[model samples]
Target: MEFFPYDVKELFKQIESKPNLWNRSAHEYRNKEAREHDWKAIYTHFEPNFDKMNRLDQKEIGECIMTKWNYIRASFMRTVKHGPPTRRPYVYYDHLKFLLKSDVKAIDAPHLDNNDDTLEQIPEKKLKVSPFLDEDTEIF
Candidate 1:
């Protein structure tokens, strides 16, 4: 609702009469009352100039000129993002980054519990050592 102040109508008149009005930077339009009163006139001249701003660098002069406009644009962007956002459930699963499903299954197979066959494949403990005594040195 708020905007910067500039003498657009007077300048427009000056241009109409003099035919050689000097172009000024958008920063010069920092009059609060004038902006509130003559926003339509100001926008009529300035809005088209918005398209010319392809890069952020274009807006950034020495001391941040278009504060209100920038704030409104940022607020609008935060409220209504353009698209569904650049997001993906899975980014990349190339062979170099991770092994295939089959390879993973094979690698994990040894750790997983299987039927009787796999249990039987495990070596059973043949000895249980007493905590007090060493197996290599017997008590004589």
Candidate 2:
């Protein structure tokens, strides 16, 4: 015996009693009636657009289209080898400002080959710096 949240028999009985009203706005009714329709009926659907200038092979053309669409679907539009790249979408700065601040990297810190005091190498000389003083000058 299988279990369902709603009674299947009762739902069907309700459908038999009073048919549901036609909801024109409903997405469920859209292009659904012809879902099982033959795709080849659409002319543009089979057109070789990927290799426009090159001599197209029928097998390669279909494979290219299928790969873009269905073959190993998880990778979608991206090639599997170029696995989902690390992208910083929402940035604190604008694209131009971000490019200007590209020198600062979180983990790309300057390292010394010698296992010496990297911090002590810097002379403790206090200097007052202000962005308002010189806009052209870059801070280290």
Candidate 3:
């Protein structure tokens, strides 16, 4: 079954219930088994309509959901890193504002900041004059 915009919104709602799918700091997000379990929960939510033809397998459904999630995430990150574009933001932008909580930390993360130490120059060693060296010798 083709997912309409509303269906996608419902999917996001389901994702909201499962932090592993969106919250990176969640322990489940780092655990492969836990993540797969959460994915199963997400895919199951759409089983009724999605499996009407029994054409889509669990993996396919998971991929489709993840693809949508990735697109929305990328769009959100863009708006966060840069300002909103001339066009309006994604339809679900407001619904996904929860992302800002995590993204704000990432935006202000230390790695993104410029360090003063990196700008400091190391002292150069001075060359000593050798008494035995010929004056005619060209350093170049």
For candidate 1, which ten residues in a row score worst on lDDT?
A: 93-102
Candidate 3 residue lDDT tens string, 1-140: 34633387777788888888777877777888888787777777777555453645656777777887888888776765565665565567667766654445444323222343222222344667688889887665
Q: What lDDT, from 0 to 1, does candidate 1 have?
A: 0.34
Candidate 2 lDDT, 34-127, residue by residue in tens: 3212222221235525335344564554445334323222232132223234543222212112121211221122331224322123223457
Clash pairs detected, candidate 1: 5-31
Candidate 1 C-alpha lDDT tens digits along 1-140: 43345443333342233211111222323555544334433343544464365556434421133354344334333322232134321222111111121122223223223452222233333566679886687654
TM-score of each: 0.17, 0.20, 0.63
The runs of at least 3 residues in candidate 1 whose Cα sits more than 4 Å from the true structure, single-residue gaps closed, are 1-3, 6-65, 82-140
Candidate 2: regions farther than 4 A off? 1-43, 46-56, 76-85, 89-140
